[model samples]
Target: MTATRVILIRHGRTTWNASARFQGQTDVPLDDVGVGQAQRTADALYQELVGTDVRILSSDLSRAAQTARALATKLHVEVGLDERLREISAGEWEGLTRDEIVKGWGDDYDAWRRGDVELRLGGNGETRNEAAERCASAIVEAEKAMDSGTLVCVGHGGALRGAIFSLLGTPAWPWHAMEGLRNAHWAELQYTGQGWRLSRYNVN
Candidate 1:
């Protein structure tokens, strides 16, 4: 059987990102730097994957959708938007900066940084397991749309990280080791009948 390749790209930087604020599900758009990043990324990916049968998928959020649109334009394809690809909701912590969060929920914030998946960021945010399950399911479902080819998923950092863990067939524990995806960078994985293999991770 042919393998299915998934290229997971994190969305470009938003104003919130530059400000070091947690965007969560805020639907923030890409900033100027982010726009440029998306354009450059699209150009690179176009040269790399345009020769193949490529499909583009993105989170419905503006930031991710915008980045996906750039790639779609390069490949001359439509962007498939999926909410399940959205970032993990941070609840009350959505708009806060790291410093602010530290001040408000010091212990919980430290716990989260220490890899406690259940220590919700705002005491009401989506748990790590929940985000991982949803994002992984979305990726698997997206793969079903094509039999054998490349699927580029433009998503948020948190959700994409979750997807990476789930798709790699490992428990979400020790997630701290799986560094977050940098803006406009990507991780590539191949899915076979036996399992999924991470070939390239956090590549620009």
Candidate 2:
């Protein structure tokens, strides 16, 4: 048996998110609204996935793990942790806002925002391609552990988006066509035997 589907879910929002600050690999927990979102999302997912073979995986970060725990509790399954699912490391820019980053690294930030895949974020962070590759690898690893079941991967926005870009084999850098996932939103990908097909994206 092989995994036929993948559900990529972004963790709930944090105070940092509300402030437009970069959380990159930070262990920030979910805010109250985020907790509510997680519960609602878990309820919806439970309804959709009940009686189906499901496996829940999550980033080791607190925010993502917390969100994953909600779903896991609903499904009565243990959440598996994968460090590779962590958000793109922003290094010096971890807690800074976009404006702050732009103020400090104006040229580089501009290039990064323009979808320059080669730019190392925060002067010492992971490149877009690098993050994408690692995320893709983590997804594959999760798939290998499952057999013909829907694999739910809970993670940060940037890393999960990078996973989608890599898994879909998109040639375009930065994948401007794909928007970021809202807090607690999810994207679904199906394996058509021939290749992976996006069944749904940014679904709440």
Candidate 3:
């Protein structure tokens, strides 16, 4: 079987990110600093990913899509936007800060961090398991669609990390064992006979 190589990138910073807002699937745009980050990381990734059959896929949200566009342009390819790659919906938590969450939903937040995958943080929000499933499904289907190539998937922090956890065959209890990605940083993985293996994490 052809190896399914993947470069999983976290989208660049948005105004919400800088402001420490929840963001979620609120469709925030990248900020000025984020634009520079995208360009710089695109240059770096273009060099790193050269000579591969590259296909770019991004979350339909503006922040992620913008990041994908920058990197895809550098690689001379059009970005494929997919709504499934979007951030987990925060529902009522959207636009709130971490401190705000702590103040308002302290017990709920703590319980969630303590491995309550079924606990929904906000009204009409997704559980951790649900978010992981959506993220993982997108990657799995996309991998099946491509015979061979590097799949550069750009998405938000929460959703991207959820996908990683799901792909690793780990339970949500150990979620914090894997740290979240910095803006524009990427993790590289390859599907092989042995299954998916993480080659590196947080490479810029």
Among all candidates shown, the one with the greatest TM-score: 2
lDDT of 1 by residue, 1-204 (tens): 343789999999899999999898998999999999999989888888877888888999999999999989878899999999999988889999999999999998888788776666587889877887899998988887787879999999988888888888885559788899999999999987788889998888
Residue 21 error, candidate 3, Å: 0.9
| lDDT to native, each model | 0.88, 0.89, 0.84
Better of 2 and 3 by lDDT: 2
Worst 10 residues of 3 by lDDT: 168-177
lDDT of 2: 0.89
Q: Please give the range of 10 consecutive residues that has the lowest summed lDDT in model 2.
A: 169-178
- Using lDDT as the measure, the top candidate is 2
List residue ranges in candidate 3 displaced over 4 A. Answer: none
Q: Which candidate order results from sorting by TM-score in descending order?
A: 2, 1, 3
Q: Stretches of candidate 2 above 4 Å error? A: 171-174
In terms of lDDT, model 3 sits at 0.84
Work out candidate 2's RMSD over C-alphas. Answer: 1.0
| Ranking, lDDT, top scorer first | 2, 1, 3
Q: Write the per-residue lDDT of candidate 3 for residues 29-68, one digit (tens) a residue.
A: 9999999898888999888777878889899999999999
